[model samples]
Target: MNKWEILNHAETACYQEEREVLVRGDRRWITALHYAFQDDNYLYLAMDYCVGGDLLTLLGKFGDHIPEEMAQFYLAEIVMAIDSVHKLGYVHRDIKPDNILLTADGHVKLGDFGSCLRLQEDGMVHSSLAVGTPDYLSPEILRALESREGYGPECDWWALGICAFEMLFGSTPFYAESLPETYGKILHFQEHFEFPPLAAAVSAEGRSLIQGLICEPQERLGAGGALDFWGHPFFSGVHWATLHHCTPPYQPTVSNGTDTSNFDVVDDCLSRMEALSGMRGSQPAGAHLAFVGYSYMATGETKDCSRDTVMSTDKQQSGDSEGLIRDNLLTESVSEELPKPFEHHLVLSKGPAGHVHGDDTDLDAAMTMELHRQLQEAEQRSRGLEEEIRQLQGELESLRARRLTELNIHEPHLFLPAHRLDATGDGKLAPPACHYPLVIRLHRHLLLFHRVWRPGVTGESYLLVCAAGVELQAWSRQQSAELS
Candidate 1:
C-alpha cells in the first residue's frame, strides 16, 4: 500500500476509538453514534447529523466573538458534555470550539473523541504526545511530555477556559506565531494571560468562571464533576436538572436536517504526505480480531433478515409433489456419479433363485481395487500442494524482512556530533542543536532532506521540518555531511 493508504488506515483506527467512546449511550450533550462498520480500506461511522454546524462556524458568524449570555448557555452544556465523558473514565484531550457541534436548535453536542484516553485507577492518564490543538493545549499536557508525569480530566477544563476566552474576546489567550512561543506562554500563563480592554463589557461573573477553569490543576473547576459547577456564579440561574430543556441563546438557521450551509465546504481531495511509522505494510494475521465485539445493535432494534425471509417464503411456495420428485431425482443422479465407500457391499444383480451372479461379484471386486488406487493418488497430490505452499510462505516472509531492513536503512534522520548527544534529557542521543536550515521533500515515495533554520526566543537558531502535514523538531548541524 502507498503512504496515503496507510494514513487512511491510521485514521480508521482513530475512528474506531471514537466509536468506542460514542457507543456508551445517547446522552443529551454527547453526540449519538448510531452504527459503525468497515468496508474495503475504509471505516464508516453513522452519527447524529448536527445541521446547525459547529461553534467555530458560529464564532465566524458573530465576527469571532459572542455575548456573555450566549457564551454562558453554550459553556454550561459543554461542562455537562465533558462531565459525561469523565464519568465514563475517559479524558477528552481535544476540546475546542470546532468540536462542539450545534444542533438545528443551537444546543451544543460535543463530538470528536479521537484524542480521548481512558483514565487509570488513580484518576490520571500518562501520555507523551501533545494530542490537541496548540492554541488550547493545557500546560500540564506539555509538562507531562517532558516530566513523564500524569494528568487528569482538568486538561479538558483548561480547554474550556480557552474556549470561553475566545468567545468573550476574539482569539485564544496564549496564541503566538510559533508553537514553542505559544507553549511557553501557556507554561507561564500567570504572567502571559490577561483580559484585553476591548472585552471590558464582560461581566465579573463570566471572568471569574474563566479564571477558575484556566488555573492550576488542583484549583481548576469541575474536579468533583458537574456538581462543582452547579453553584458557580456564571451558571447561577441555570437549571441543573433540566439544562437541555432551557431555551438556547442562539438558534441556527438550517432549512433541513442535512443542510451544509452552516459549515465551510472544502475540496475532498487527499493531500500528498509521508505515511506514519509502523503503518506501511499489511497488518499481521488476526489483526481484525481486535474489533470482534465492535458491532452493536441498539436495544429494541431488529437486524434486517429480508434475504432469509424471502428464501423461506420461496421454499414454502414451491412445496409441490413435482418439486419433491425433481429434488429426489437430482440427489439420485449425484449419488450415481460419485462412487460411495460402501458401494461394494451392495449386490446389484442376482440369479432367478436369489443366487448372486458371478459376473456381478467380479465387477464389484474390480471397482473396489480401482477406487483404492485413485484415493492413494489424491492423497499424494494433496501432500505435494501442501509442501509447495509452505515453500512459498517461507519466501514471502524472507522478502518482507529484507524490505523492512532496507526501509530502516533509508529512513532520514539528522546526524549530530557525539558531544551534542548529551544535550538530550536522560543522557540519550538527541537531535542536533537548533538554528540550521532543513528542507524535506517527497520524491517517488522517498523523503529528501536539507537543512534550514529559524531564530528562537533564546537567541539561538532552531530547525523545523514540515512533513506529513505536521511540524517536526530536528537536530542542529553536524560538521560531517552524511545523506544516509
Candidate 2:
C-alpha cells in the first residue's frame, strides 16, 4: 500500500488509543488523555489539553535538567504510575521523557502505553518480548531477545531509574553514540556507568537510590514492589503518598480549554485534521479507515467494554469538538477525566550523588570509583554464566511439568509464580488453583486456562499452561507433543 493508504489504517494512532484506554485510564495524574471521537481518516482522542507541554519540552525549557525539586516531584508521580499499572497487570514497555507530560501546575503524568503488555491472569505474563526505548531498557530487556525469558515488573523500575538519572544529569546514565555502545554500557553498567562531576552536588541518598534501581535485575531495588522502594533512604523524609498534593515547581500560562500553545505537534495535527469532516469536500465521506469502534475513545452512546465502535456507529452527541472535549471531562460514559494534582511536600533540595563509600568528600570519591571498579569485575565474571544456567533450568522445568501433565498427576509441591498465586496457610503462595478446562472473560478479552504440574520447591517458579482462548484442547495437545 502507498504511504497515504497505510497512514489511514489507524494502527499508529490507535496504539495511543488502546494503551490509554486499557492502562492510563487508571485514574491518576501522571498519564495521558483519552479517546474523543473519530472520522474516516482520523481517530480523535478526548485527552486533556496539557497547556504546559510534555516532559521533554519542559526539560528543554529548564536547560536540559529540571530543578532537583521538580525532578523529584515528577519522578515520584511516574514511579507511582508504573507501580499502579504493574498492579493492574499491565506492563508499559515504553517509558521515557517523550511520553511524559506536564499540566498547568507542573504536575507530571506519563502517557502512551501503546507498547504495553497485559499480563494474563493465568500467571503467564512472562514474555519473550523485548520492546522499548533503548535508552530506558533494563539489562534483562536489553538482552531479552537473546535468551527469551521473563523480566516482570522489574524492567519498569530500570527505565524509571534512567529517567531519574536524566532528571539530574540532563542525559541518560549510560547513553552513547550508537545502539551497540549503549547496550554495552548497560550490560557492563557497574564499570562503564559513573556519575558525572555535575552529579556530585546531588545528595548521596538520592544517588544511591537511582543506583539501586538501575542494577542487575536480581540486585535491582524494589524487590518487594513499590512499597519497599518507597522506604529507601533516598526518599527519606519525603512524603510519597502525598507528593501529588504538592504545588508544582512551574505552572504554565494558558487560559482557554482548547489552547495548543505549548504543544506544536498538536497544533499542526489539528490544522491537518480540519479536512476530517470534509469541510471542503476534497475527500470522500465513505473513503476512510479510522473508525470510532476500531479506535479507542468516548462515543456518547456506543462506549462499552467490548469496544463496539464502528463507522456506522452513530455519534452520541452533536458533531462538535467542544462537545467531545466536554465529554472527556464531565461525561459519565467515558472512563477517564481531567487529572487533578494532590497535596503534599512544599519544598525539596537536590541530593548529593554517592555516599556508599563513606562521607561526601573528595577522598570518598576515589573510594567510590574503586568500589565501582571492583563491582564491575565481579559482574563480568558472572555475566555469561547466568544465561547458561537459566537455559538449563528452563529446560528442566518444562520436562518436569510436561511429565506430570502427561501422567495426570498432581504435584502439590509445584507452584506457579508467587505474584500469580493466592496466599494461604502461613502466608505462602504457590499453586494458584482454579478449575481447569475453563474459559473466562477478563475486562473484555477471553482467556483459556490450563495448569502446569511439576515437582518444585520454591512454590513461585511454576507455570500454569494457560493461554489466550485460541483453542484450549488443541494448544494443550501441541504442548504435550513437544515434551513427548
lDDT of 1 by residue, 1-484 (tens): 2323534455323444576688883346677766676533444566667767899999999999998889888998898889888878888889999899986566778998878888999899888888889999999999998998999999999999999999999899999999999999999999999998885699888899899988999999988777567667777656544456456798676544456888875667355544333543755555445555656544433222212222332343456232331233233322232223323433223334533333235544665677798899999999999999999999999999987664423223444232232344455543433433233322223344344433453333233333441222222222223352
Clashes of 1: 15
- At residue 159, candidate 1 shows an lDDT of 97
User: Candidate 1 — which residues are off by over 4 angstroms?
Assistant: 1-16, 269-283, 301-484
In model 2, what lDDT does residue 196 have?
90
Pick the lDDT winner. 1
lDDT of 2 by residue, 103-198 (tens): 544566667666676666653245555567888988886566677666667788888888888888889988889999988988888898788998
Error of 1 at 444 (Å): 59
Q: At residue 234, give the lDDT of candidate 2.
A: 62
- Taking every candidate in turn, the Cα RMSD to the unseen true structure, in Å, is 27.8, 20.5
Question: How many clashes in each candidate?
Answer: 15, 20
